[model samples]
Target: MQALKGIAASNGIAIGKLKLCVKLDDKIAKKPITDVEAEIKRVESAKEEAEAALNRIYLDALKRVGEENSMIFQIHIMMLQDDDFFDAIKDCISDEKVNAEYAVWQAAQQFSTMFAQMDDEYMRARSADVVDISKRLLSCLDPNLDSGLDSLKEEAIVAASDLMPSETVQMDKSKVLAFVTEQGSKSSHSAILARTMSIPAVVGLCDAFSSLKDGAMTIVDGSAGDVIIEPDEATLKEYEQKRDAFLQHQKDLQLLKGTKAVTKSGVEMEINANIGHPSDVEMVLENDADGIGLFRSEFLYMESDDFPTEEQQFEAYKTVLEGMKGKRVIIRTLDLGADKQVPYLNIPKEENPAMGYRAIRISLDRKELFVTQLRALVRASAFGKLAIMFPMITSVEQVKEIKELLNQVKADLKAEGVAFAPDFEIGIMIETPASVILSDLLAKEVDFFSVGTNDLTQYTLAVDRMNPQISSMYDPRHPAVLRMIQMAAENAKKAGIWIGICGESAGDTELTRFYVDIGINELSVTPGTVLELRRTVQQLD
Candidate 1:
């Protein structure tokens, strides 16, 4: 038996023979494409195969993960059918004089390079489609090349040197069990797809996975970050007992669903989810949350050439409100900067992007973009409960500017005879130290406050989030972070404004009593966390 510790990406357990997914390194092909028309025909055939594979996964996934979510394959479909993609192939086949398969694959390689350099996460995911298309093209061009998918016939744990999102789409449903990837992380598309499929997964185990030969007896406990290869009798028995206990625990968690978030004394505490997309409405509804507390609206802006218009914003917000059936949905205006630079805005390169122009700073500078989102939020308000919050508010001046813009938006709507909620609550995320320390005065002006502990801790500690050297210092449990959160809550309590916690600390059960003790009423977290939070709140006296 061998043990290796790594960042636990997903939580689950599995015991099956390991199935390794080898990532072929990008290298020059032996038999390259040499004809132009032949390359086009070859590309067409590869795409057809990819489309069929995608359809197969979509059909199988619809049985378990619903049609709405299993549609990640469509992203690949769009890539395969892209027009510019075919043009690039023509250029490559005509100029490069390579074999038809190699020509299309070469063109895809260029596209892959372009995607890999992009800063956005969703765009980065498209790199997988490029690789998938290329590999599929190469396989079709030469009938002799091996895809190594024959391993799926046996019941084994799926292992990959690196699995892209599209590659995992048509994964073996019954024969393949869990996933172990040398590349990617929890947030990576490969791991996310594995988790959604209810398959146990472990990533960042560079060379540890391959040490176990194919068909070797293995036990992968993703929850505890364990991988046992050739386990002894005692080890096998221990895991068997553990696996049985985990099954029962899952059953217990299922019972917690739909139960109102109440304390031991029946104190009805507000616990809501922080969603990123309109699709997350289903998650909140499924979790039976009190309402939507924080909707990180940055997602809409990231994948666009220009800012989202009022109509598009209104439609997205309307979907969420209708889905929640009149439940409260708080949407934060585009909170982006270095980590989330808007391609349209052209943010300058910064040594530390985390501290650079981000959140409210960018929105305030681009007032038109800010107003558009506000107008949408106001219009969405007529459909159901709605509240708007600003992010990265460091000074009272910033809040005043936002207030003025909100007023201007409301005035314009009224002037145009557009029906919208006349009066709406305006709040700011207390992310910076300046906001937290001066929460008392700021609380009087804003309707409410939400402490964003992730940034709060980073700024207080003066550590850049992306800098690996100082990553070990990012402890939300640090006394400084606790003090700021407590201070913000206390100040908000004194001023009689509703205070919330939307940061990762809000979901921490160990700090639940402490947060409640400090006078925080609303807790906003990921939807998957609501049940455990409800249990914790139930235990709170």
Candidate 2:
């Protein structure tokens, strides 16, 4: 038996026959076009067809995976119409005098190459999106050509060089027992879809693809990122037992749904989910989270082409609030800047972005942008339980300034005859060391404290978490970092305000008891981890 290792993208185990995904060869020779206008028209028509196809796919994915995960298709549709991208195709057709298909391919290559060279991991992963959209355009230009993923005849493990987001979303779900890809990271859209669909997936198995024979019996342990091809009898039997145990564990976790996260001693803990978009509420509801701890308001801006208007932000917030029914949803206001940059905002790039103009700094500096968001949040408050949280706050003065802005927003709304919940709570994230040092004073200024350990650890430890050279030094469990969190918890209690953790460290089961002992009232984590955290909390003393 040949065993291969890759990055685990989802949790599950599957043993099935392997089926190689079939993809159409898109390589085409560039040919001279006699009529440039006709070529442009052909390209435009192909784009229209591609957009329509994507819209249909979007609806299908929306129904199956909810809106958040399915937003990839909507993004694909947007990318098709982007001025820079579409203009490149048109320029290639007119300037290079090439066929529509050739122009599309050329444009795809150029943009994909540019994106591949990007410093940001998210933008780099988008290189695949450029290829996916171009393939769709090619299919539109040539009716005979097609993007695969619809050819599955039976249940099997789907292996491919790489599955695009569209192909993964459109694949026959019942026939796909698991996914094995030769190239893709855990953050890839295909991997995200696999997680959303609860399909076992192992990606970035480049060397193993050479030995992956079609119809060969294979065992995929996604949780362990292991794939064994043509396993021996003993190994197969062992894996069968392992798979059974994992399935049982998952079934047992499902039983924890709708149950409170309470210890044997009857200490109730709140298990909430951190979400970036409205559609993620579906997963939150499915996981039976107590509430949304960190509603990242920046994604609504990042996902858009330009500044999202007040009404647009309001609708998005209102959607999440109403969906949660009366459960508290803490929305962090506009944490933009640093790694999360908006090109239109045109904030000058800095040498040190993490400790630079980001989060509350940008909000306070750009009062117009901050006011617009606060107005939207105030309006959304009428829909359900809403709490506003500020990030990267280092002083009481910043909190006072935020309150001033919020008070002005309320006054405007009240005078305009608009309905808003006046009882909405205010909170601040304890991310910076300065904030943790002043936690007692900061806590008194807000209704609650949510320790953002991801940043708190980075700042306190003097390590840039994104810098690979010293990422090993960035440990949230560092005694110093934990001490800071404990200090914040103590100060929150002293100020009569509740405290919680809303960071990557919140899901660390090893630290759950430590947090409980430090008087942490809540733990907010990714939606998939809610049940696991609940199980951990229930087992605690």
User: Candidate 2's C-alpha lDDT?
Assistant: 0.85
lDDT of 2 at 477: 88
For each candidate, give its TM-score against the true structure. Answer: 0.74, 0.79
Best by TM-score: 2
Query: Which sections of candidate 1 miss by over 4 Å?
Result: 1-4, 26-156, 162-176, 183-199, 232-234, 265-268, 302-306, 337-342, 346-352, 457-474
Error of 2 at 381 (Å): 3.9
lDDT against the true structure, per candidate, is: 0.73, 0.85
Clashes in each model (backbone N, CA, C under 3 Å)?
8, 0
Which ten residues in a row are the worst by lDDT in model 1? 62-71
Count clashing residue pairs in model 2.
0
Which residue pairs in model 2 clash with each other? none
Error of 1 at 217 (Å): 2.8
Tens digit per residue, CA lDDT, model 2, 246-290: 889988999998899999989889999988778789989999999
